[model samples]
Target: MHLDPFELHRPTSVDEAVRLAGELAGRFDFLAGGTDLLPNYKMHINLKPHLVALDRVSELAGHSLSRLGAMERLSRLEQDPAFVAAYPGLADALADLATPLVRASGTVGGNLLLETRCFFFNQSYFWRASLGFCLKADGDRCHVVPQKERCYATFSGDLAPPLLTLGATVEVAGPGGRRKVPLEKLYDTEGDGIRRLRLAPGELVVAVDLPDGAAGQRARYKKLRVRPSFDFPELGVAVAGRWNSAQVDELKVAVGGVETYPRRFDELTEALVGGPLSDAKVASLAEEITRRLRPVHNTFLAPDYRRRMIGIYVRRAILEAREGQGG
Candidate 1:
């Protein structure tokens, strides 16, 4: 696979980037670490005419415990022991994404705004041409679900779940100016999966802000993938909560790699917050989540297997997070 030539635009500031995006409109894609986009480009997936490189954008560079820049590389975050220790669940996700080499070039924004994946969508040009394409690409129908109304491509990103557990929010910039949106609302599952994120036409993610309370929570992330070193997750589960003497104070459970979006079970998790999360309760929670998710046969794992593992992984993540506090 080889990257076809395209016009590369480097913006020194956020304003410049936004201007460039407005000028280019639908003909451009923002280039972060290029770990994911480059590969797709090599396979001649969605070839945009212009590439907006964010490397020189000063507004999208920097990282602290409270805020992580959109352009921050995963390798940089993993190298910081304090950052990793503060959010162990996020650390697990960071490590689990691709491999060391890919992580070296994978940025937080790239991962958060990752493209939806499907078996029929992520193939070479010749393969997709032979199959007549899918809803996410050049065709009118979804190959995964055999439908024309909605795309069933899975949201395979791992960062969103752990970040949602931490109550993270994202800073976005557009022609209308900057605004903040909760990370949980970032992925729009209700809409046609082809649209994916909730961002406007010219908007771009600037950074992700972490809440002060998220720093001390007992958090854990568990991912199921075909290959540990390099492969997208078939299922990723994350749990974060504050425990007090066998009772739950605040709890958030998020799962990705199973559906169109990485979702938080706020209704289910909120119901058990004031009470204790016993083994039986945890098992029920797991079963309910397993029942709710709709995994398609897109990735390496079967829909049934992925659905079954949801209960197991969710239970394990919640239990391990609870055990972390030893109560």
Candidate 2:
């Protein structure tokens, strides 16, 4: 069936884009790679009257590395010098999204600001229609986990987990003014309306900043999905920490697919601070953090299984980050 008809606008600068978007507010949408947006558009999701494309704005495309020289080195004996020196955990996080072709076209801004997702929520209009809409899609009540007052759609993207661990910040330009905020603040715990991105009317994400400390910190992302590749995460964890001599000095963790927003396990973070990067402590911390997670049945897997896997993947991520610390 044909999707709804809409107007499209291409503005050359951030100011212009914001003005048009603000002027059109509820009627407009800011387009990135059309990666996730277009599909939802076709499904008659939000029903905006216009598509405000951000393609002409040149600022959102490139990426760069910051210097974090104080951190410990991960490996030595340099083999494939590029591979040996490269930040695979960081690079791989970006590379692992959808596919190379999609990556080439996909904007980092779009990926960071993706809408929350779930197995029951992301279907085509016809598919959703057949089952009746769940809380996230069309209907008021959640079909995936009945009696739930709100939606439990999982936020399942790869970039966010690592970015959050790396202490990435998002910059936005809008009618209100330009501002940058920690990516962590962009999300809230609850899932309805699902997006935690706090961009205002006419605002568009300009660039993402990876802090200098984040560049040097040892970080890794572990994603559990049904397929080996390309699928959204069933459970994902990103952990970044630095070792000061022999003790874990600082740690940042971000988890996806188990909640409405990518979440940080503060209790575990507090426990790791000033503690040794020992195997036992990390495992115990993971176990303790898993107990705090509240996974729901919106995903393909059972909630109990997803909840248990969060701890498993969390421990794996911690070990990977520790491994990168270079004993």
Among these predictions, the greatest lDDT belongs to 1
lDDT (Cα) of model 1: 0.91
Identify the runs in model 1 with alpha carbons over 4 angstroms from their true place.
325-327
Clashes per model (N, Cα, C within 3 A) = 0, 0
lDDT measured at residue 191 in model 2 versus the true structure, 0 to 100:
41
Q: What overall lDDT, based on C-alpha atoms, would model 2 receive against the true structure?
A: 0.70
Q: Report how far off residue 9 is in candidate 1 (Å).
A: 0.4
Model 2 collision count: 0
* Per-residue lDDT over 1-327 for candidate 2, one digit per residue giving the tens place of the 0 to 100 score: 356888999987778888898789788788777778887877777667898887776654444454211111112111224432344455556545566556555666677778888766677777887887776656777776676567677777777787777777777788889888887877765445444556665677777776766655677777777776577788888887787766888887778878877877665687769968788887888887788778877778788888888888888877876766411
TM-score of 2: 0.87
TM-score for each model: 0.98, 0.87
